[model samples]
Target: MEVKKNPNIAVSRNSSLYFAIGLNVMLLITWLSLEYKTFDKPDVLLENLTLIEEFEEDIPITDLNMPPPPPPPPVLSAPETITIVEDAKEIEETVIESSETSQDEKIEERIVEVSDVDVEDIDEEVSVPFSVVEEVPVFPGCDGNSNDELKACFSKKINDHIIKNFRYPQAALELGIYGKVFVLFTIDKDGNVANIKSRGPDKMLEKEAERIIGLLPQMKPGYQRGRPVSVPYSIPINFQIQN
Candidate 1:
């Protein structure tokens, strides 16, 4: 046997519809509450209200005492008009000689003697290495028979000069700086030592080496091909601490 109930009396028959309607009503109430706004009403007194008129101040018209304009500039006299006159003297036209040779022109065939040409000797500055110079620079008090002997003497003199002038820099000695300085100097054609340069481990050592080399006396200029020439010489100076 099947039991049947009436739809109006069933509790869960329209539960979804009832829930949907309740949810819509709640959403409408929330929207209305959120959209509602209140403003404060300020109290206004009709007696305190007044209309203001814009007032314009009248400034007095006092005339400013300005200095009178400077006197008119002096009138300048007009320059005399120049009158053009025709020159009566006849002008001589300058004749220009043409340097371009024509085909019919003959070239002169004069004999040029070697003796007729004057030769000027220009003393040009030439530098030569000390090793290959025909004649090495002669140091003072060095007398030798040949170039080899002169070179040996020169070396000996340089060594002696260095030994005589060698003074260890106090700063370098205190700093424990010691090294060999390569000194390059040029013996100019004037027999003077010039362009002294040095390279070492430290500036103090190099400076000391340069100072010693600067004391070298002027030497006889080197010779190359029967002409005096500048000689470039390089030597290493050892700066050793005795300690």
Candidate 2:
């Protein structure tokens, strides 16, 4: 035989409704508390941004990903280089002359050369005219033989002497320059060359003319009234180009 056990259910249909309301209120309060306390739990471990997040705790995005930013660009400053050069220069020289007094600096006077005159001065005498001393011989020393032939012969001789000795200045010929040379001379009673000179246009030619004049030979002495007399003469020498 089955023992009959009494079923003990304290909630009755009328109280069931009140019990359900209380239970529902309790459930709501529990859910709210759990949500405030544990619903937001996340990972707190630092991690690489490249790695996947698999934890249930809170983790900051900043903490996980940043690479450091590249170490603030390395502090830098421009480098400096120096250049040096050596230069050369020339030195100038100065000279100072000794100072002298006016008197000390004065130059000495030059001496002058005076040439002697080549002619002799004659004395004049006054006399009463006497019978021309017989007109004796004025030509041949007291013998009045006026020899025209002798005069002509001497003139010819003088001409020959000049023609034979006349010379052109060699220096001028070598230099290819030419000119005329003039000379003044005196022919005494004894047809001789005297007071010879060269007053030419050029120095060399003048010298040559003088030389020729000096080379003249003596001639027969001339007579004027039985006495030798001096006579003036001239000579001309022409220079020309040589072959």
Highest-TM-score candidate: 1
- Model 1 spans > 4 angstroms off: 1-121
Candidate 1's residue-wise lDDT over 103-202, tens digit each? 8989989996766668899888999999999999999999988999999999999999999899999998998989899999999998999999999999
- Which runs of model 2 end up more than 4 angstroms from their true locations? 1-156, 189-191
Q: Against the unseen true structure, what C-alpha lDDT does each candidate score?
A: 0.93, 0.61
lDDT of 2: 0.61
Can you write out model 2's per-residue Cα lDDT over 1-243, one digit (the tens) per residue?
897655565446458799889999999999998888546678799876796879888766674665666657777898897865446655567888767667657787999998996998773321211112112112221222435444444445555766788666667778877877777776555556577877767788888778777886664344345555555556566776767
* lDDT measured at residue 200 in model 1 versus the true structure, 0 to 100: 93
Residue 149, candidate 1: C-alpha displacement in angstroms: 0.2
lDDT winner: 1
* Candidate 1: worst-modelled 10 consecutive residues by lDDT: 83-92
| RMSD to the hidden true structure, all candidates | 20.0, 51.8
